[model samples]
Target: MNKELWEKAVAFHGHACPGLALGVRLCEFVQQELGVGVSPDEELVCIAETDSCPVDAVQAILGCTMGKGNLLCSRAGKTAYNFYDRGTGTSIRVVARRNTAELSREERRRQILESPLEDLFSTTEVKYPLPETARIFKTVTCAVCGEGVAEHMARLQDGGIVCPHCFRAYDR
Candidate 1:
């Protein structure tokens, strides 16, 4: 990871590159720096710190890694082993490509963890709320008919919420 470039990307993402801004930040990084459209199979060259879990730390930035890098991890210097099945020569959740740059939504959350954050957030964090929850209307039953009733003829003539069929007597 180029500290300058990494910091630049972080700044472009408004500090953390935040929740969904990962892709947008990557696009900006590629466009402004790589000068090429991301092919989804692009490999990004990164500089890992001397004492970090390369896979866990860089996961969010690179999307994923082979897990078994010949080079010992920069942080712990441990040989990271990617898991494989007994019969199948396959590792689950292996990052097939390096993509710190792509659309925001398709981003694997790992990249979010590896991203360098200095500008937007710090030890301090703020939580944002979700959009308002819309109320769902269920079937309201008529007391007299004992059947599910809706406001077919109902009107708010009084301070209460009465079904249309029941409102008739009140209206009269």
Candidate 2:
């Protein structure tokens, strides 16, 4: 673990929270496992299982960002991440151990920062296919909600585009 890198991650993420520390360590682990440094482009893709403080750390330390189309989020509600090496087609999934869940938020933060990386996370090699449309999408207007949405995300209904929210309303 690089103290300077952790400090930089903390500065970028605003506060020294547990999520941020986990992200910093996860990024470090990914770099070590892949034998590469922070990525500048789509060479690395990160699929975060939740939208949390740690995502900011991932953006800063791993160079994976939503704008760059390399950072993806899922509503799994778990503090896990899957890092894929586009060049080598190698991937790894990392999940925080359940032991940390029993601690208070402050204690969790302290443990994440001070404990060894092996104590905080469980990692495994995984096979995941990268989606072809992950990086490309067209912007379109949702007729039902009058909101703008990605063309790929907008559903076609009655000859017009509808956002997912409006489409769900119709479904119910």
Candidate 3:
């Protein structure tokens, strides 16, 4: 069995690994480890090792965290996909905090190719932005279905409104 592969299959705290990061059993473990005790029936997510240490400082250096989500397409034919840790196998979603968006998707990915994985997240953390906090210009209603405006459903693209569901694109 690949030790590296196994480590990829566990979950760990988003930032500053908890005292009990004994292999990620569930995404909720972050809460449980802190004595929050999660319900076993709750869905769990897999957390891939985000560290790129030389098989030594993987735990101590791993940074940056993201959860699974569908791909989003822009009117400009741009495709934006959310990053997630596939190892955990959980359905939990982690939001991306705008404050921590230090690099463009292309830049961050380019970084992943040039440097050790840990460096990619050196300044970033598991800080995911909750969808609830993400708001559109005037309302949270889907431009197409007029349903609950979700972060994934609504995105700001060059001063325009984009509804990911029906792919609604319009300028303000």
Per-candidate TM-score against the hidden true structure: 0.19, 0.81, 0.21
Off by over 4 Å in 2: 100-107, 144-147, 165-168
Please provide, for model 2 over 84-142, each residue's C-alpha lDDT reduced to its tens digit, 9 standing for 90 to 100: 88889788888877672688888987787778877877887543456343556788999
The digit string of per-residue lDDT tens for model 3 on 1-172 reads 2234234433332321211122222222233222322222212222232222111112222222222112211222211112233334323322211224587655643443344322222222332322221123445655446666555447755565556765645558
Candidates 1 and 2 compared: the better one by lDDT is 2
By summed lDDT, which 10 consecutive residues of candidate 1 come out lowest? 122-131
Each prediction's RMSD to truth: 19.5, 2.7, 14.4
Q: How many pairs of residues collide in model 3? A: 11
Question: Model 3 off-target regions past 4 Å?
Answer: 1-63, 67-139, 150-162, 168-172
For model 2, the local distance difference test gives: 0.80
Over 4 Å off in model 1, which ranges?
A: 1-27, 36-43, 50-172
lDDT per residue as tens, model 1, 1-172 = 3444445445534444333243333333333333333223223322222333223323344332333221122342322222222222222211123345664643444455456532212221111222122233466655555566544443443565556665656335
lDDT of each: 0.35, 0.80, 0.30
Please state the error at residue 16 of candidate 3 in Å. Answer: 27
